[model samples]
Target: MTLSSSLLNAFAPTGTLRASINLGNPVLARRTDSAEPGGVSVDLARELASRLGVPVSFTSFERAAESVAAVTNEDADIGFFAIDPLRGAGIAFSAAYVLIEGCYLVRDASPVTRNEDVDREGNRIMVGTGSAYDLFLTREIKKAQIVRTALSEKVVDAFLRENIEVAAGVRQQLEADAARTSGLRLLDGRFMVIQQAMGMPKARGDEAAQYLREFVEDVKRSGFVADALARYGIEGASVAPATPV
Candidate 1:
């Protein structure tokens, strides 16, 4: 019923799954002294913890770099974010819990309608630095000026100020930004598809990791996963039923 001494010493449970995580500042995670619950990332984390019968603790940082570092340093047991192979080399992952499409946020009056248009002439795209979208743009996209912003929120802000012609990020983040601000539109076209999962330390010997994976798989097996996305008003995220054990 309790974690062994070795396990306890490695990752002291805060009664539930102790996680040091952050949603991307503006969209996925937000921190405020206000009464609001901030974002869906925190909401999902708590839900997963409650189901797992563990208390969830968070070390909310302002950036992914900080969150990743915190997890690596054992300040947090897990990080809820997109999985990167480079980072995955050092972190373990539950099965991908969600898949999201990256999209374009263009000015309402812009002539740009597709990826082809950006390369033809004067156009600028704003992206979050170190984000998967940015990595893809730098690799597959050419001919446009790519400006790297600090985060999804910053990219949204820059586009709002007309500093960049377009912003690229997850649809949820962009649409959420648009919901709060005017004159921004999420273009109908998708730039990329991204898969998000829970992250833990790289050590494979940890029994808790298996529990984490099983817990995630169970969440998918149950109706809970899709319901959480629905509660967040996320339309595209759907979990397929689990296969036979």
Candidate 2:
């Protein structure tokens, strides 16, 4: 793909494309044995840079909020994040490239057996601070009080340590936690499906956003997303469907 000069400048004002990588979502990114960032998001960033004819540099964050901040503040040129209206204020997102489930986890002995029972009064739910599930549950869960931990990876620990009634997070993370800890299990179904997408600062203009949207659709259509997921051994997250014309 040949990028316009204006689009290239919009994405790489510093002469290199700076991508904000969030390690909070294991399905999107993770630290390899070499202690460097690697995963589907990293792959996409590199691909974008390759097309733009610029070098790619990553600014890694342990939390989604931090990664979003980097892009929103223009400290980084682009980022991957869950599509949320609150974040749309500063970031213009592409159509989602991945769909991940948001699920509830509770002690096996707990009375909550279904997704519908989790919002009842007196049930305190633990969530990662500023994560997609946290933002989602804050709006949808009217009765249950939300408890927050520093990172998504720590939600289960906080839930166990603090004795919260429910823990909310990505399905894969919660499933792994359930396996690692005894007497815990996931609810039968997901409460929500998180739409993960690429985003850049809204200041970059509508043309830039449109280009990104097209780039996302191209990658999804070309099997780049599915191939990346399989290569990374990510399960339970599907490549997002193509956007309607």
Candidate 3:
């Protein structure tokens, strides 16, 4: 795609595309052994910068909310996030480029055996503050009380620390935590599917947003997203399907 000068400026006013890299979502981004940002989202950011003929700079955040804040406040030009209406108020999101499962984890001996048993009156669920699942469960879980930790990576630890009945987050994260900690197991099915997408500040306008949307669609169709997932050995996440014409 030939980007207009205006669109290019919209994406990289500082001559570099400042991409907000959220290390919170392991499926989308993570810290490499060198401690630099590296993952599918990082790859996408580099590709977008290359297509725009601009250098890319990464602004790392340990939490999704911080990443969203950077983009919404225009501190960064672009970010990867879960598609949620609350976040959409300040940002224009493309159709999802990846899909991740949101699951619940509990002690093996706990009574919460099924996904349906999580919202009981007495159950308290742990989640990452300001995460996609946090927003989702906040809206959907009417009965259970939500207890939040500072970050998604801390959800399992806090769940154990606070003695919460359930812990909720990305399926892979929960699975990893379960494997590391004895007596914990994920529920059989998922509660929600997180739509991971690229977004820019809403003030960037429709043309800029349309360009990003098309860029995401093109990458997904070309297998760039799938290849990146494989290259990183990321599992339990799938490339989002093409948007309908």
Candidate 4:
């Protein structure tokens, strides 16, 4: 059959995009209207979808690692993860979107109050499995015997129940749960910069790579990323332009 000019036009890409957010960040999560995506990552994802003239959809996941898997599995066109090279195996990353300092978790009654405190004590530090924080703990943290566990929520639970001395993870992750345990406190100490960004499956190489770079660049140039981060009380996170300084 001969192709008509109108037929070719209808088949053209509409710049439509699809994405998902990791809902583990309580600051960005809303329980009342759970269907709506309102957090930092969700805001950025929705903005990009709008800019691309696509209908945006929202979904939630229990962990960041699972969110990354959604992308590779094609459940989502894109998903965000804290920057980890190992996580990059099945997907591609844009420039980092935000960086948050990580710290240690201690009981309210524990004497451990600083980074050095964890080091001075016997093994107690535990981190989420396949997390950038875990990589940092292994390479840079000393003094605490680092343990990796899946289901970070459970990790915290185990720490509290199993008589573990200390646990370290993302700042937001701990802050969101501090109230539930009654006596848990996030010890004050800078462990590492947790940089996060969206990842796309490597199968869409050329198109995905271009889209990510442009998305990061556009957000930075417009000050949109900075505004979004600040709106969510995520200070110290800057939107660096893709251009060389």
C-alpha local distance difference test of each model = 0.69, 0.94, 0.94, 0.68
Tens digits of per-residue lDDT, candidate 4, 166-226, equal: 8777776676678676888887757777777667777765554666667776777788878
Q: Candidates' TM-scores?
A: 0.79, 0.98, 0.98, 0.78
Kindly report which residue pairs in candidate 2 clash with one another. none
Tens digits of per-residue lDDT, candidate 3, 26-76, equal 888889777568999999999999999999999999999999999999999
Candidate 1 residues 90-124, lDDT tens each? Answer: 77877776777888888778887775576544777
Worst 10 residues of 2 by lDDT: 27-36
Q: What is the lDDT of residue 122 in candidate 2?
A: 96
| Higher-ranked by TM-score: 3 or 4 | 3
**Which should have the higher lDDT, number 3 or number 4?**
3
Cα distance off (Å), candidate 3, residue 10: 0.4
Compare candidates 1 and 2 on lDDT and give the better one: 2
Q: Kindly indicate the candidate among 1 and 4 with the higher lDDT.
A: 1
Candidate 2 segments whose C-alpha is farther than 4 A from its true place:
none
Backbone clash total, candidate 2: 0
